[model samples]
Target: MTMSSVEDSTQAPFVAPEIVTVGELLRRDLHIPDYQRPYKWTVRNVAQLIDDVDTFRTYGQYRLGTLILHRDARGNLNIVDGQQRFTTFCLIALYLAKHTSADVPDTSAAALPDVGLEISKANVQDNYTYVSESFGSRRGDLSHWAEFFLDSCEVVVLTVNHIDEAFQMFDSQNTRGRALYPTDLLKAFHIREMSLEHASPQLRLAMVRLWEEIPPESIHQLFSDYLYKIKRWANGQDVPQQGFSSEHVELFKGIKEADPSNEKNRWARPFLYAKNYTDDYTQENSTLIRYGALSGVEYPFQIDHPVLNGETFFLMVRHYYDLGLRCGLFQDDAGAIFDVLPELKPVLDLLDAHRRMPTHQLVRNLFDCLVLYYVDRFGEQSLDRAALMMARYAMAPRVQSKQVRRAMVNNYALGRSSARPPSTNLFQELRLATRPQEILRRVLASPELNGYPELHCLFTTEEGARR
Candidate 1:
């Protein structure tokens, strides 16, 4: 693959397996880069981690997993692998250091014993409670456990110099642990790209702040399900069965370095140097969404947006993320469509009232196709009719889907399925539906839908806020 080919050209140094205590390792600056996902250890995950450490301590010395790091332009150790354990250990160390508090937030990661970074409140409370119980809540026992955790607990450290090789190692190692989310990899790559582009310290930190501000769930859905899906359809291609993944990230990444040695794609090099002038920067607003909607920071921009550098790339990410959330919420601003939005609320409500009904996915997928078609063709002016068409089209597939072709919901309100639903292949149909009129006509005329009942009940249900 690309990783293998890159490895062949650029040999990354892999250090020998040397064991170091948590205290010894934390003595250096170890940072979980802003791109990494937040510490989201469940109470169970935290309990299991501590239990493993406590169990290992009984054996004299416990060997923790390997940690992966890449030296950045500034020469800080940007952690790539072992984030889960590393962050957990740091939090545990802080708790032992009596640094837990709600009002005071820790954002420094310099010295190990003094390293103080804020973990999520829920995780801290849950984990500290678990640790208290795990060590029997005695001062002597706690002190001994802390010492063992800091001095005896050891891990193998792998420091990679090359960014590409580091990512390769990160991905490979992730398979043996908790996999880094695709977005995590994307963030690491873009940060390196920004450094390569020689972006200013202010600009680089700005992008980092922007990335960290975005809600994780929103970005995940935005990339994998929304923007990626829409982009493929716009290009008249079938959506990949795997949805968006690392490969798609490469496509988004494009060519990082121009082939000056071989001579091709010359414009790419100059484009990377293009800077965003503040006077020309403007507030971003889209039919799908507005910039800074989530973070409250208006992102700077460039005229015509000539280059795909880190800043612009994240700008693209944020733009599509906003659009995706709006589409999912059925909050499109198609002028006259506001009149239709209130009328369409019931359909969204019914699906949600049942926790998105017989098939949670069926409802959302149906909405995706419908919203995509509406946004692409008739605009929000057609939302009311679009909702109706979606409701009817959903029933059309019921005729054939054995999974959803049931009456259990009918015991109260009949619908989709327990697992996969009737809305499977529904996007292609909605894509073809184009205009609201076309959607209404095409769905009503489907041969498979022979004699489905009227969708009057779908409209009659009491309204609810959009999902």
Candidate 2:
């Protein structure tokens, strides 16, 4: 009877032991086992590995370590442990292979260089032997894994009776030294299994670029020191960091800390405002709508929103951007924001007046003014008296959340009756205005501006009276 290639069930048990490059390992579809935990390697960890290899010639010789793999029922080498280290090594290898000429064909074997040439040749050779013996008898198909491990790398494979042992081994290997963050572990899971290998680079690159812009030092410091502050705040205790949920706040902190300060680092903070830019391709669709809104220079779409996703962030950014543009709010770039500082001075002063007020309130008030200015300019009804009173009451201590308080100020500016409940009179007044700027000037010069305890005069009148 014709028999299969390996019909010798009773023949001497043979194992294929061999060395391989990372390429082959990857080609085999070799990956962490289902029972294996996610990749917990942080950006710092990755950065260090690359930095070590780049800076120290022999860095690869000593062998950072190895991983043990066993053939699963599917005949695949399921990583039992050392997945993080292995993955990191593979990443570095891929980067090096791309950056260097090691993978080029038609080159002499003598010219092909080892990744860890700085390591003693003897140590490198020993590393090769260690990897060779660990793969059992399947050496022929392991050229890729071998090249990476033996060339100043070391890995060992062993058969295990159960998956629990593998997990314990994994935990033990990764528990010490630099602590791996849970968020970082989550990142690995998202990157390896959750995301498609052939995913679009545009989205990923944009996320990475934006994340990189957040000052690394600031992220690290916030995680290290201020993250816990939110916990206390959430628990109703006084804490430094405010406005974030305790659990999420701490999680963000941990991730921020896990990110590397090293130059070789990859990955970045998840984009908090990624949706902002992605949602609108043009500056006109942005929050400010006008190019030269805040800076008065009409800088095209200079708005910077924390890269977040979905409609909430989209609308939020849109509203804020529009308000800032209309009100000419300047955050940075002194030359751009400098001119409007005077107009925003009262808003800033009112915000500073209350120590206990929430941040959203302050920002809201600022935006309300912008909306008022916009509505007055474009709306059929000029909200004269209401606009005047709105500006007047905005000077009050409690006028935070400029948006919520906007209607109030708009109603008051018309001056139908400051205390009157909601009525069509306010809307009608908004319609009848001839000059809205006149109302704006009156609001700016009203008793609220002059009498505001915190207000300070920048310029003097002809008679030297408070202007």
List, residue by residue over 1-467, the lDDT tens digit for candidate 2. Answer: 00011222443232343454434344444554332333444555655664454354444443354555654334445565566666555544443443344442221111111212232244434433433343445444344433443354434444432333333444444445534433222222222221122324343333323323333333333333222222222232332222222233223222122224422433323332232345344444555545544321221221121222222222332343444444433233332432332434454454434423553343234234333343524442334333334433444323322333433433443333244232222223333445664433432332322232332221122311221
Cα lDDT tens digits, model 1, 357-405, are 5544443454554464455445466576667556654544443343552
RMSD of 2: 18.1
What RMSD, rounded to one decimal, does every model reach?
9.5, 18.1
After superposing candidate 1, which stretches have Cα over 4 Å from the reference? 1-17, 31-44, 73-75, 94-136, 175-178, 229-252, 255-309, 329-346, 358-360, 376-381, 399-443, 446-467
After TM-score superposition, what is the CA distance of residue 399 in candidate 1 from its true location, in Å? 5.2
| Alpha-carbon lDDT, every model | 0.54, 0.36
Tell me the TM-score of each prediction against the true structure: 0.65, 0.27
